[model samples]
Target: MAKISAAEVNKLRKATGAGMMDCKKALVEAEGDFDSAIEILRKKGQKVAAKRADRDSSEGAAIAVVNADANKGVVISLNCETDFVAKNDDFVALANDFAQLALNCTSKEELLAADYKGITVEEKL
Candidate 1:
């Protein structure tokens, strides 16, 4: 197997928001192929999501915001499997960011399809 460089792992981490170890493992498993590494990371996320699909996610945060015009309002909710994760500062900030993104959305589909940073809001979540 080819050696996985730290730079490569960091690049993958930035693109996928995956952990350092995960990015490194994916890169190793993909033999340093960036696209393949991304797919592997995505599959890992999907697997985790499927496994947790039936789990109770009653813990999280909700944020409501009004546009600068004061005419449009949006509410966003982010749910997590654990109260600890829900209470995390990053998690709360993410919920707030979603609320701001929601201001531009006319429907749930639009919100999901909208871009947050460079990726779709759905992908971000």
Candidate 2:
């Protein structure tokens, strides 16, 4: 197997938002191919998600919505690092959108991939 370089690992880490070690391992697994390493990290993220099923995600905000014209309503909350940040416009917007997508978010993993504003949930984080 070809040895991976640190610069290559860092590039993968930056592109995928994965941990340093994970990027390095993926690079090694993919034989230092950048694209393959990204795919490997993505798959690993899915595996990790299943393992985190039992973890608590009680720190997010709860948002509620009401569609008066349609006689429908919805509510959702997005967890974040702090209340102050939670109340910010961007955070509030995310929480609202997540709440609106609550019915569609089949799992935590799916929620992470769902688009919020212009970016994915992971990128927002």
Candidate 3:
């Protein structure tokens, strides 16, 4: 097996916001290949999302943003499984970011299709 460095694990953790151990395990499973490790982590997130599909996402934050020109406005909601998660500062900030992204789009389809950081907004969900 290839050696996994702490730097590589930290890089993955920073990029994905996954737990440290989860990032390490992904790196180990990918045999130290960075991109493969990222893919593994993304797949794991997909599994978690699938498992949470039945969850009730009744708690969330709503945010609105106006374009620089002030002619267009958009509102977005980010839902979570629990009230604690909904109230988290990070969660609110993320919702605001989504709203900002939405301000530039014409339709819900376009907003979901928008690129966020690296992946599509839908993928981020």
Candidate 4:
């Protein structure tokens, strides 16, 4: 087995906003390969999403942001299945990030189609 260092796990955590243990597990599963580790995490996410696809996600963080001029702004809701997930600091941060990105979009379709971390925002949803 490849020796996975704390630094590698930390790097994946920084890049993916995943928990330390999740990152470490992904790193170990991918045999310490960075890209493969990320892919592994992504697939895990897909599996989770598929499993919970039927669940209602009414709990969420509503984020609003304005541009530097205060003239342009966007409001977005990032939803999850539980209050625990919705209340998570990381989840709120992700919502804020999406609202900030929406500031650049001209329409809902544009926002949905926008690229987020190599995939569309709709895909992220």
Say which candidate scores most in lDDT.
3
Ranking by TM-score: 3, 1, 4, 2
TM-score of candidate 2 on Cα atoms, chains taken together: 0.55
Q: How many backbone clashes does candidate 2 have?
A: 10
Q: Write the per-residue lDDT of candidate 2 for residues 38-118, one digit (tens) a residue.
A: 889877887877687576655657777766475666666566555677678866776777767655666778878888656
TM-score of each: 0.86, 0.55, 0.91, 0.75
Write model 4 residue lDDT over 31-95, tens digit each, in one string. 99999998888888889889999989899999888999999988898888899999899889879
Ordering by lDDT = 3, 1, 4, 2
- Name the lDDT value of residue 35 in candidate 2: 84
Q: lDDT of each structure?
A: 0.90, 0.75, 0.91, 0.89
For model 1, the stretches where C-alpha displacement exceeds 4 angstroms are: none
Comparison by TM-score, 2 against 3, better one: 3
lDDT of 3 by residue, 3-119 (tens): 988898899999999999999999999999999999999999999999999988999998887888888887798999899999999889889989988887889999999999899
Deviation from native of the Cα of residue 69 in model 3, angstroms? 3.5
* Residue pairs with clashing backbones, model 3: none
**Candidate 4 local distance difference test against the native:** 0.89
